[model samples]
Target: MSTDAVLVRVRALWEGLAAVPVSFSSATGVSVVVSPRALICPPGWMGVVALQGEAIVTAPSSGAAVAIRAAVARLSADGLVDPDLLGRALPLAEVLGPAALAYVDGDGFRPVSAGSLAVERLAVEDSELRQLLMVAGDQDAAESGLDEITSPAFVIRDGGKVIAAAGYRVWPSRTAHLCVLTAPDRRGQGLARVAGSAAVAHALEGGLLAQWRARASESRRVALALGFRELGAQLSVRLS
Candidate 1:
């Protein structure tokens, strides 16, 4: 995509997310706060909790505006979404995606030397080769899916197999939506931290925010280990 095209797409995305208002009351009398601007969700997914930093928004799947307001009122006068209470509000709520706590910090990001990990940049030109290395039995298969990307990807090799991977989905070019996958057998070996550092370093180097929206419980360890900070979790779901 051209620079102008990227700028246009990013601007439209930001505007869409900003249009949604923050609310807490759902028609179900649940208290929650939501970003009215948050537009990311799956089809038929009525309920959602949009989160960014301290900013939050909640909308019941039922599309009840009153529920959103009431939920917020139940939470507090300020009406901020508290992730801990989200489950109690909608415990059975089918998660539309990997419901995760969002963590991000730039205090320790630096250019990573490949080291003994043999980290390499996986570019779009090698999509065919990348697919061959994307093994489902690799352990982190559940989380390793390259749906799309704007930045060059990163990976670490062990023996001859790809043990870990890192990359970002660029939106607005300001925040890099980070992605990572490590073979379950190779996780504790610090391959993820090492490969992730390279990806993050490149993100910061390009003047982008290294956004770490981690989902897996163990993912926090990798993010924090790589010098990222906990920002909070963003929750969303597709109402059954």
Candidate 2:
């Protein structure tokens, strides 16, 4: 559960949160292409994925910018951290490109935290899974792999329709990359947390590290409620 472990998987194109290896690194640098085989990446752009004191840098024939080159060299040379130097060399927005800081549970398993709402994992065979995906507007993951979401894809229903959903995609590291969705109409009802909690419970049962990476402040709140610790920020960025 250490941050280093999480970063290792991510550097290898595996998502600690998604619990799946990114088919390819789509989050390429703004101007360079690190890996030619990566998906959704243009022909050229430097890319960097940094976390847990490790930096994974990819570029076509190395990056053109001297600042980025030096910064990457520094990260490679220094195993420890100096927040100021890192801040100067690798600003998150600049380096990670609109990246987010997140919390990872390294010490112990966090219990589910949603209140009294009932949340059950969605079954691919059930019509509710499709309905939940439609209501939550998350057709990409939930819809494409309804059966693949079996371990802990959960949805909370209101009047027999889905209102909120949460689940984890398992990774090679046994980390559960959590996904939570709630219908716009159902906001402020605490249903996101409720559904999320159930998914975490299932992740714990399978002995997965529950990783919560938060892009929005609202997601951070839910992770905190679930007892995840705020680790330092990491970026999968495209260089400008």
Candidate 3:
């Protein structure tokens, strides 16, 4: 299959999940209101379900329409939904497909300085940044709806222009996942690492554990460098 075709399928799946209305919390000090209307799931084995708000989902609800809602409610009441909320409730065995959690070891990773780049937290005021991220890659093009929700983000700027960005859709559990992008012109400068570190420190300050869904090789390298270990893998079913 062509690369574009693969990306299209991936985007569709992620958008579908993100569209689900489910509240979530993370150990990275990120909280969001993941209304079904504003969900943006990430594609591939990341199993990223972009939600808004600070709620947890435990068990699938009785009705299909409200199953995720029920899950979050159940998890929240049990108090198992705090700090690494998703990790505690959604085990890889249950949430991911076979081989979804597979990854290679990433050694020789190194941390970067968080302050080397000019970073700014994005808010509703930073619509341009959102727009830029919305089209950062073909995958993002498939999930364009991500622009509708305003999550906390950090941008690396060069001479008043954004060169890279990293953001988290916080959940109640004090953990947040890292979503980063570096502009084509700024790849080698370690802008992603810098912005990512800033995001991690932000999460740590909030008593959250920062997590990210990365490609096997990329994840191994970045996570190891940032002190993150393999949690599990999330698999995707290609539509054809």
lDDT of each: 0.54, 0.54, 0.45
What is candidate 1's CA lDDT for residue 85?
Answer: 57
Candidate 3 regions exceeding 4 Å error are: 1-111, 140-151, 238-240
TM-score, structure 1 vs. true: 0.69
- The alpha-carbon lDDT assigned to residue 175 of candidate 3 equals 38
Q: For candidate 1, lDDT tens digit of each residue in 62-148?
A: 454455554455563222334445444433346643344333335455445566568788784475325534653544443554435
lDDT of 3: 0.45
Looking at candidate 2, what is the lDDT of residue 5?
62
Candidate 2's residue-wise lDDT over 1-240, tens digit each?
Answer: 676665444444423322223332333322222343332222344444344444434443433445556675554322212334556665433332322334455354456654666776666457766565665555443422334554656888788887777777675566676777777687777887787777787777776767675556787788787776654444333444
lDDT of 3 at 231: 33
Worst 10 residues of 1 by lDDT: 46-55
Please give, for residues 1-240, the per-residue lDDT of candidate 3 as tens digits. 333333333334334444453333356322223333332322322223322222222222223224333334445322222224544434332333221111111221235676555678876348667556644776642222223323566777777777777665554333355566766556666676787666666665665445566643543465556655443333321111
Best by TM-score: 1
**Model 2: lDDT to the true structure:** 0.54
Write down the RMSD of all candidates, one decimal each.
6.9, 7.4, 13.8
